[model samples]
Target chain A: MAVQEAKRANRLKSGKLVNKLVNEYWEDLINAKKTGKKVVYTTGLPIGPFMAAQDMAWIHGEGYGARVAARHEEKEPQTFAENKGFNRELCSYARTQMGCAMFAELGVPDDLNPGPIATEIPAPDAIVTCYPGCSTGPQWDWAIERVFGKKIPWFNVVIPYHMGRNGSTYMKGEEFEENVKYVVRQFEDLIKFLEVVSGKPYNWDKFQELMGVTKKVGKLRMEAMELCKAKPAPASFFDWSIQIAPVNYLTAWPGTVEAMQAVKDEVQERLDNGVSAVPNEKYRIFWEGIMNWNKLGWMADKFASYDATVVAGRYTHMAFWHEPDTIDPEHPLRGIAINHLECQLNLGYPITEERMMTLSKDYSIDGIVFHGARTCRSFSRSHFLLAENLNKKMGIQSTSFEGDMVDDSFYKEELVNTRIEALIESLEAQKSRG
Target chain B: MTSKSDRSSFYTMGVDSGSLTGKAVIIDGNRQIVSHSVKQLGFVSQKAVMMAIDDALEKAGLALEDITYTVSTGYGRKRLEIAGKNLTEISCHAKGANYLYPEVKTVIDIGGQDSKVIAVDPSGNVKNFAMNDKCAAGTGQFLEVLARALDVELTEIGALSLQSDADIKISSMCTTFAESEVISLVAEGHTTVDILSGMHKAISGRMKGLVGRVGMQQPVMMTGGGAKNIGLVKALEKTLGVSIFIPDEPQIIGALGAALFANDFATGIRKKVEEEQDLDKSRVPAKDCASCSVQNFQLNKN
Candidate 1:
């Protein structure tokens, strides 16, 4: 009953509100003097399963007071004096992350107000990182040392490339078991360290309960996958993706089972009614790059007249299935670790190709669409090859469109529409041959 | 000409002495050894060539005398005094990617000064390649400059980007504008972590634009030092929506491929010599130098 109340309370917290609170919690930690609490800092990508896993791990394990610093999302305001001396031809990720670090180091208050930055989170006591899968992860660690004038102890969990695939490679019974075993071992060690630091007993029962929730959530996810396969496809890939967030964030929490149950029951009921999540299937194209500021409807409406449904996409299913099923309760952190390693962004190109092919084949996709986002190279690097190969290999027509995830200027409707039209025609011709 | 019997077991070397680095590959008839030694290019290219050759021989556990033939490549190829032949970097990279992964059809190499997108056949032959050597946008130099501006080491960029929480906007595409933007952000009190994330996104975005032009193929391997950057790899994956393969040692792919070519070229030469010997009895002595009838004959046949 208490859990239900907690879930209800959580439900009332909108994403924006939660983000604000998280921001405030960080601010409090940054301002507060050392309370002898051990704070471990970890980095994350913005959109992948690993990010959710890290969030859950921190929230559940250390609470909101934990000094969690994302590599860089903060923008430092530029003064006219400094602007004159800055170079114009630098990579943007470096600029942003470095800017944020400088901002934090100066102890400058938020430029918006005359007070300290909202999130004055203190320097991390220790750093946990995944290796060089992304440029920002390593760079941020360097920035921390440069700005803070100290080197934090760093530990890493290596994610192999084999975990990104779907079939025998990733879901192999023994391999999955071994993966779980490895993660559990790591978690046990982490717990021991935490126990020593906190001067408290590790909550074995809490961990077990969390594992149970994870198993339930995993089962519910399978059901959701089935729902995705439902005749006519139950909902928009965008909607389905959003609905799965709770399952991702709360996987190891007590609320997860109920959240998964609620989501599953809701989806199942919709499936039974033969109702579609998004009634209009305009131009069903695969979306690339995190959906433009969650403005999926913008893209959906663009192809609405053409009956596009966005049958499959990297931002949706590609990111979702990247995580393995969490069945074992003994080592909960292992499941989180797997989720971290299995993120689409973390796996290098070979595994990405395999996953793209799998999603295309499984979803009966019509065409491959790539977003030539201006801000990201990791996701943009080999899209052209992927598109060309998919066309030749799978007979699925493909096209690359230009757009930024945040900046609207990069998204040109006319240019994108023309390309989309050509792609659709090509896909239609291929479909006719079948 | 080297006799077929004597050259059958002779080792050959291919030195791809590039602007940013030097590579030497030694082929011992049946096996190949690739040794890559990276150093700054000096006024004279011979020093670079010698260094690369020595490195290759050391790696192969063979002496310099064991190498019977040498092929050189890259911009400095012509300057290598010991080279028997010079090849282009494009051919060498294609050959390298094909040698490492026989199934690879496309090679995306992000080198220090330039980025190249190559399309090749399964047999390691280059079909077509588009290069962005003129610009720094999609090359490793772009990242290096960004690293300096951010005050972070180049090696740590990839691991650091994994920490990004927000998608900080990088308004500039030009390297100069981008650097200033980073500095301004620093003055404004933004975290260095966010700026670096933005820089990676920008570079990935530029590379995506380049990759979009050639079209991608499966089993695509990333070559060059930039491949070492984990953050860029992830950014590329996010942008392309496909996974990229990084071999055990990504930086050595070009050298390895060049070495494989040495083996193939030596074998081809031996075969050619044998074929010539067999045709010696039927050889014609005289031919017109200025006006050859072969062109007319070929045209007539077509």
Candidate 2:
């Protein structure tokens, strides 16, 4: 059979992809129901599924979507209502994710969207949660229960953190295979639950085809990262990082492999041409913290003009690193689980720091710039001390900049520019003296 | 062997067991350094201290019996059993700063895992201080990571940052994000010089934030291993709009402070011992004196 027909036939057998597509298609159907029109919901990290559901829901008018996030305050609020029922000791990412969920259920006014938006978004008619190990996970479960009551459909995907980071002791060189198997099992369970809830037979062949396509796409994506390992790959860490969205969202879909194949071809062409991602290459810097979501273009342009390049960052690497080289048919679900768990943000601080140091050494960074986000205490909490230590111990120059990833108002370009100018002069002087 | 008074009057030893390195300083009473040694800390703190002490003694042309008193400071100050007294790193740093430049009012010490901004009175007393010990963002470790990211030697960071012609503003405060930003910039074809400059700016900004909290006072003295980075020093001066004074051998300030304390302690001990001897002589009874004389005669006869 031709690749397309083979994919179609395979999708028909698995039923997972068909189930997701039907779920998305069912958003419109659910919105048509008077009782389910104003749906509200909450979600956790590896937010691609939730986002996809939201996008689909918006198309179907299954009610407008709003993501709940946590705010950082010096003092914990006195009451549960005031505190939003969150643990102050938890990381900011967990706090925010949980806080958003809490606010949604309690009908608190949020800056993301004032008043009530949707009681629940329908794309994810049922949640397929992986782990409740992090503080955010349990709170997220509680928040969902509080908001939707017991009426909402949910499935748990038990992801042991030890298995994710430490790899499986039960298997060597087959850890990824084991992890993927677990994911496939969860996917199957999710499909079964959806069929029962929707009262429709999921097309198994389409699902298998989708999974097959995803497997192929996963392979190609790994190839893309490997391509970067080449001497003259035509990409930066940022390029590779941003490209992860399609890989994550479109995975297990028929179109993913083709899309990734095209990207790989382009990357190969660039590599053949011996083209570097950044042409000017004036000064190379290492970045820390979350990217400014709104001003990435602006920031990139500003730095590019100065002939300065950002060599590495946590966000970009999270997407590119730790990809499996080949797919395991026997353990497809396990692969998905490993992919989700291995993200940079999901790892603990010690591991993150070790990776950062390794990247710094590997990249030959001149200096480090730490972005201390106002909102993300999880990522920004100890950055100042990290910078100080780097400077003192390694004889490297380190500095911190304050701003939020999503919020643009916190960034003052004029103040930032002045500081940059002075810093450059200082660097120049040091070079001359040396 | 030298008499206790002679030993006390002649020499003193200072040990500073910093987080990353250990230093030992041997000085004569008259402000002349007999010898000094530095060693990077291994897993064992005591071993590092012993090695440093042995090396300093070997270099100083002195024996252990010749040393009167030893003062210790830095993170491992309390672990030094051979030292007579332990002083806080802050106090020792200030003393060292004063010894190098008596006019310095502000002292900045950047260590491996922490950075401190210290304000000193004319008498070298610490008046106020601010410290960032919670993260490695503005510390030496950040630089080490950046150096690795750039594939450059740690010592080359300062020189490279200084060579940049244009300023690259790295806006990430988190080390992870900052590294990502660097990678992105490199992909976009940014020059290493600009990136280095951006990094220097970032460090300067963090230092300025801490310095601003303490209020910048002149003459500012930059100490610690971080002070070796001229780019950082210049960046700090620019950020604070003030000149920074870097003394010779900036890393030795803490040990220098310990040495000064040792000198004072040794002198005080000598005075106390002399006073005790005088008291003992005064309290001598007549019968005891006769008996002592007889014993001395017998000893002489023997």
List chain B TM-scores, each candidate: 0.81, 0.85
> Positional deviation of A230 in candidate 2, in angstroms?
7.0
The digit string of per-residue lDDT tens for model 1 on A230-260 reads: 4456555555444444443333443445655
Model 1 residue B61 CA deviation (Å) reads 83
lDDT tens per residue, model 2, A232-257: 33555455444544444333433445
Docking class of 2: incorrect
Docking level of model 1: incorrect
| Per-residue alpha-carbon lDDT of candidate 1 for residues B11-98, written as tens digits (9 for 90 to 100) | 8777766556666767666544534555445532567667767876887678877776677666566577676655556667777788
Highest-scoring model, DockQ:
1
